[model samples]
Target: MGALTPEVMVRSLSQVLSFILAIALVLALLEGYVYLLFFRRPRALLGAIFTRTVQSAIAALMLLLFLRFLDRMGLIADLVAALGLAPLLTLPERVWAAWSALSPMPWRLLLPFFLILALELLIYFAGEPRPSRLGLAYVLILPALIGISFLIIIPFLFEVRLAFSNMAMYTAQNPEFGLRYGIENFIKVFTGPVAKDATFFEVFGRTVLWTAINVFFHVTGGLILALLLNRPMRLRGLYRTILILPWAVPSTITAMAWRNEFDFRYGLFNILLRNVQQFFTDLAAQAQSLPLIYDLLAWLSQAIHPVPWRQDPTWAFISVVMTNVWLGIPFMMVVILGGLQSISQEYYEAAEIDGASKWQQFRHITLPLLRPVLVPATILGTVWTFNRFEVIYLVTQGGPQEKTDILVSSLYKAIFQFYRYGFSAAFALVIFFILLLWSIFYLRITKGLRGVYE
Candidate 1:
């Protein structure tokens, strides 16, 4: 390209100044609109416009000074050349380029600021009276809802788009590659070849089973502990503290420790089994004269072998469940304990006056009262256990040939291990819908929320 002439430089600088002045003019108009329509202060509107004009003029001057330095250093032309825009650039385009190079104010921030101001103004003008606290709170909350849309809802929409598009590693690297939008990924999740061995249906079933079993144990164990702790007993606080320690301990550490203990050889469980086997063998030798006793003893010796806790599929599933139960029970206990505390003592006292047994009191008063608390807690526990990846992974690593792989862990493997981004996105959405529908169904069936609200 030929060198930038003095004429081109002068033309570009004038365009830049014109663009900045146009922005200042827009801001003056906006300030007048806000002051008159919102503030209803026509007398102060000119002052506001003047203040904004001065600020914009100062900003424009500073931006021009910075652009001049870049122009003098020949950086602007170099940047245009590097970006392959040199041949296409007009004087106005070059001016805009210089403005953009300095990363002038982003619309993301300014748009929200203006939007919030507009909302406040609308609320202010809605009624003859000044806006109430509730109106102001709603106006303030508008930005936060926008923030949630960006943070959560936007990524979800992106995932949904990926689910429909062919977004594998190849497409990720090749921008020119056309994304075929279809339900092919979703189909692949069901009856495709990959689904034959560890099908989505199978994994989903296992996930439900895992959740049901864990939640069952968590509630039962936690309820038992909470009941014991709620009684008037010695060192009750100490007992509660000690029982809660398992939960306070980091889950990863607890999982690892349990994994070691479940080892087939030289582990605590196996070592104890071996000791029991040795005792049986000794007892059989001593009972040789009593033929029937010796036979029973010999059978007992054979039955006392070390369990393969992690290597076998069923055993590994059980091992992960055990670890998760340990980690989960404490949370259930705390939640149930809180519910127990909220129950009225008068109900129990009335039951006792009626000569109701302890079981009757618990059955009629405690369980009914605790339902409001436990129902929601149980739902949350079920969902958490459904997605419980750490304990399962840390303990069993979804081992025994992926027999223990839950839906979440399986999707994780699809993304990281297989690099099947589109497939994983589809899988994730499937899981999301399943959980969503399940939650809706559960809440509808229980109608337990009505009691809480009442």
Candidate 2:
């Protein structure tokens, strides 16, 4: 009744159609450029590169244009309306009427169809399909490449576009929002008022610290447990099950449970500490000779109040890290355990004959052998912990005054809470570059991807 009036929708549809036709026109020009490059010039290495680039670019443009055309064409809507699909079938007549009213964009859809048809005809008259291995590969691979391009590359391009534009919530709701491209969003991320207080650098450092601490503990704890479990011992299965139970539980539930346990007053942790303090007090009082124990207990109990784990910044950070480490270890433990089982016992036996101690055997044989498996697992764990949002959010909500806010959580706040889409997108791109650079550096340093040959 309000904004669903036919006139408004028709205008919006007109604008959308105009946008599509414009894109189609551009694609047609690019296709013509491709034809000129290959058909007119004798084939050369430089020309081949140019031709390939133009072809790929034009193909991507056509695919995106086709999708937008189909969406605006209301093909899905028409099919659903005809078939009376579930949920749509149960909708009231007024809803259906409104949908039908809003769906189509007049005869403008014919523009793209005719433009494409003309391009195909031109190509058909100019040349026939050649049967080459390269052509065959293109036929097989182009669909998958196009799918990935649409799924990943296009959205990434959109994010980059959004980063450059002033596309906040206001502009987001308005389809005719004008493009205002500048480095303003990037500027704000680094030097704005938001950056002045708790700078992006600080958040980034804390994030690095968070990732380092969590991964260190996860890798070490998991490796230790994995080693223990890998040994031939009785009740190893039971120990493994009990150790891995923390990871078996969902992270949200685990975070909530840990949050309660970390509570300051009458929480499980404090209660247990109080009981331990009481036990020590009783024991020291009964043994009158060791009065230091009684005095120590009195002083300790009086001095150490219940920790405000979630309310204090340092403790809040520690709380989430602890919860994450617990959640993360079991996965690494399983990975390292598998690596350990795959190692030949003959290596250890030979080491034993060479008078190598257990530590020597582990240092020489175990670690070297486990490196191949652990390297990629470590990288995956590092990336996951770097971007982990759930534990941080659910545990402390990035508080005691945003002290624990990592990049991803900060991005969530900027975009969802503050509606600063452009700024958040810029911030996200910075994070992406940081991670990308680090990953490249890490892979180069480790050379983990070396093939079986030199």
Candidate 3:
């Protein structure tokens, strides 16, 4: 788009104001109609209905006229043009195209809406058993429900449809959708190279390893910090604030900063390593008669070489993992700290009185009490880390021959880099199902929601 000239800015502002006013008017009319139907309880229902029908017809006619006036004045077209959008296929036009494409299967198109309407009717009649209470609850949550339907449910349904199609860059506009296409897509995902020589199973295995290593460190590091913070200390608040900085910063920024720090030369890690190696060398020189010092210096010289973090596959994987672990630990520390504080001190006191040692007290009292908080936190942590894309993308971009590519990053590359829409959709579904099954199993094993239900 061109630079925002004053004329364009003023025209855009006017269009926004006009759109807001139109929506406000429509909402006001809806509120009045709902008040009459559910709150006011008009004595003559048929008369109220007739009045509302006539009012709605007039309101719709006026809205159409208003839109026509804007079109005649070229305000709408100007806004579209200023935004650098195609005038031929606006958002509404695209929606209309999608709707037309589904005209061949009218039942399929209307099934979700019909199901939602039926669910609402069932809830209205069968839930609460009070009209006012049901109406109030539905009115309060209707906006959220509508937002989810439009933003999440509709897009998910579209993805599922795409998964069943033979869509790619060439046939994105018109792709054949069927069971065979879906099967082929899924089979291709497993049987073909996902990204330049990286097989599906290979990427999946690497993803699992990445998640396990990161989560392990996150839990251990966070637990240690939380435990220390739980004790009375002079600089407790300051330490907590400093420790949480990694989590407080945006992940993208942190990932980029860490990526820079992993550079082979002039990077923080290599600089520190070089300094330590030099210090050891100087010490060994002074203590030349000590054979152990010479052996230690030899080990340091071998081990403290500047690491090729992004060049070597193993170190590239390690670099991303280290970045993610640092980024993830603070969150877990805060969560575990909260869980730790919520445990009653009375349990620990009683355990001590019973002659229980510190380890016994922790194993029996602390672990059991913190189960409620830790279970949910771990589940959430697993899900977030599993789908984490920013650190992997920013730090390594699944580089070093795609050795560090996780399922989500691979799926992203498939769609955006390779333009294999159908294949990526199928791959996404596979990832979703894997997480879903793992969550269900973990919940069953941990009985995480038992306390909530109780």
Name the lDDT of candidate 1. 0.74
Estimate every model's Cα lDDT from 0 to 1: 0.74, 0.74, 0.78
Clashes of 3: 0
Q: Candidate 2 or 3, higher TM-score?
A: 3
* Candidate 3: Cα lDDT at 341: 96
Q: Write the per-residue lDDT of candidate 1 for residues 1-454, one digit (tens) a residue.
A: 7689999999999989878865654454445333333333213555446545544654564456544544443335446567774434444447666766755565533553465455435434442332343554444455556458657875786577667667677776431212454467888988652322577877888898999999999999999888878877899888888888888988778888998988999678889999999999999999999999999999999999888987889988888888889888888998899899899889999999999999998899999999988888998889889887888778877777788889988887788777777777888998999999988888798885677799
Candidate 3: tens digits of C-alpha lDDT, residues 14-40: 889877765554444444434333433
Per-residue error for 265 in candidate 1, Å, reads: 1.5
Give the count of colliding residue pairs in each prediction: 0, 0, 0
Say which candidate scores most in lDDT. 3
Clashing pairs in 1: none
Model 3 bad stretches (over 4 Å): 1-133, 446-454
lDDT of 2 by residue, 335-412 (tens): 999999999999999989999999999999999999988888898899999988899889887888888788788888
Sliding window of 10 residues with minimal summed lDDT for model 3: 122-131
